[model samples]
Target: MTMQRRQFLGTMAAAGAVLGAPAVFGQAKPRVVVIGGGAGGATCARYIARDSEGAIDVILVEPSEVYYTCFFSNLYLGGFRDFESLGHRYDKLASDHGITLARDMAAGVDRDAGTVTLAGGEMLFYDRLVIAPGIDFADGSVPGWDLSKAEIMPHAYKAGPQTQLLKAQVEAMPEGGTFCMIAPPNPYRCPPGPYERISMVAHLLTQANPSAKILLVDPKEKYSKQGLFEEGWQRHYSGMITRIGPDFGGDKVEVRPEAMEVVIDGEVERVDVCNVIPGQRAGAIAEAAGVTDDTGWVPVNPHSMASRADPKVFVLGDASAQGDMPKSGFAANSQAKVAAMVIRAELSGSKAFPAKYSNTCWSLIATDDGVKVGASYEATDEKIASVDSFISQTGEDAALRKATYEESLGWYAGITADIFG
Candidate 1:
């Protein structure tokens, strides 16, 4: 499936030129300034540069030189992958793809002037802008938690130093200690991420501290892949995990980070380590651009991912409030391709194809035990509607589970190359 998708993307790129050469707009080439070089932005930049064949200039604004993927960071925590393996550099994008890399944060956006201001005080004027800044924690969503308290109760959602911190904290935990996780609400990045992290942590503790307990305080009534995760947890690490849902006062929770305690409905439970995944909103730059609505997400046209607020501005990935698509890297990559096609057609007069998107999220439960859920989607008048779907069944055999795990490995390599190169 991974190889086929890569080939399809390549075919789309080549088929774009069948319409003829681009129509030049002015003396200088039409420039696209892409903000936040993650799955969506990076893939969009690469596709536009590759497909447009120098008709358009692409500039990527991102603060990080090495991007660590959140998708497989849980595997790193489980010791399946090393930290360095999760990191990817944009050298190929700049050296080979002719993309200009601005290693600085995007300070603000002037939609009226079609300019993006960087933290370094450089202003980039663009014919089009793509915003894919991923996610930011919503302020005060967790009553007693904030960015400052992240060191104590690390979110580790962004997948960098905080991930290492959480791993270290988990490793240094006292024998039979409690590890508490305050899972986020719905619409968070990677719908099944927290549960995967729980499985990985359980994997670690099962080896090092078999008596250690995992306490999950989740506000959501149900979560992504609940049946699969519960079944795997029972099979692999029995008697080690406990989950508290809203019915059990999980929704009414607060944390005392300094004291390493969780307060659930006025009852305090002392914990050795805490992982607080808070409610999230679009990245700050999107809100600063005045594109985000009251829900703190940028709504976009289903056909092209162009911001509804401003057609020239496109929003992708976690920042976008497109319907039915979970905020996953694969979904972002799929959306990026559609947006890149539309942008190329609009700016460079390439052949535009109908927008089609697909996403599959693969998660590992234990060593060689993997499961997946995914769907194919298409642009409709109202939203990106799912057309077909598939999921791994609960009672799958060991061989099938291992094959799923191997398939995920292939996907990671294929996708990272597709995005960065």
Candidate 2:
């Protein structure tokens, strides 16, 4: 066996031996099984391991060997970044932090038994569990569209092969052909994501197919960074974009992927390329764990990010329904640190402090033109309440916008290192 595989197997065996033993017996260190290796799970595993000082055995179960971030994925579509640049591996998480990497999907969670069954059929017992599987599209959210139709109409929301497929389709569009985007509703992953994608697509079209048009079908009447994006669109690519909101039947729409058509209020429109971002819910594992509510997201205690249903299980990132936090990578990363601290304190007798969270979402409107919105939050009895907020103002000078864009680049580097290493 490879050295890494042997190490992982050894860790699993050790954990299995202590499945019925109490930590008070001091036979084995407490074990934490984190499902998902995105910003939330990776950060949580690293912090729990590093802070516990080997007092906790951290096992991260993730199917993907290399994680591609959804935050800057729009830049990849715009040709601002290469696909490889968005991918991050887990080697450092394993080697530097002594985290056990189980490259397997979590198929089931037995809350009563405190065990997680992997797709490969290995059952892992955990003293504590963290689920941060991120977002999954809701079935039947869009008529005539499903996962099977994804090949024809790419969503590109998860930031991997779908992203590459969407970008390729955009680049291959016929000159002056129309491109359509079906934006998702509220409470979806990355509130500003679809808009940022629209801006990126516009950037690409302006350069290669100047005559091409963009059709934005949005269900909501307003969106994140609306004024700023509208100003940028007008200034950068005037007369090249059109938007249909709820009043104009954007909310009542269906797609015929086979025919390359979008039906809005019974009006049929043909497009060369279609990007369909359907409504989304917590990743499936959350539901399997019985933590999610009717809203299809796990309600977390604002104080510790522990699931309201089961305190032993904590939910983070897009899978959690923490109040006032948008489902963005930055928010997920921030929530993960808080959860890690709390989990360590609970299991390892370490000091725990009040939980504070913050999030900022930055979007690139054009070359070196960026905008942002963010807020600071604190845990309250009812929810994670927002304390203060800020947003990039419209009509900013080129120098300021360029500086904002540069700041985002630095943030990407810092956050990725913070997450992976």
Q: What's the C-alpha lDDT at position 119 in model 1? A: 76
lDDT of 1: 0.91
The model with the greatest lDDT is 2
Span of ten consecutive residues with least summed lDDT in model 2: 1-10
**lDDT, candidate 2, 1-421, per-residue tens:** 1124445556557755753333444578888999999999999999998888888988899878899999999999998999999999998888888887887789999999888888866778888999999999998888999999999999999999999999999999999999999999888999989999999999999999999999999999999999999999999989999999999999999999999999999999999999999999999999999999999999999999999999999999999988999999999999999999999998878899999999999999999999999999999988999999999998799999999999999999999999998
User: How does each model score on lDDT?
Assistant: 0.91, 0.92
TM-score for all predictions? 0.94, 0.97
Clashes of each: 0, 0
For candidate 2, the lDDT comes to 0.92
Against the correct fold, how does model 1 do in TM-score? 0.94
In model 1, the clashing pairs are none
Please report, as a residue range, the 10-residue window in candidate 1 with the lowest summed lDDT: 15-24
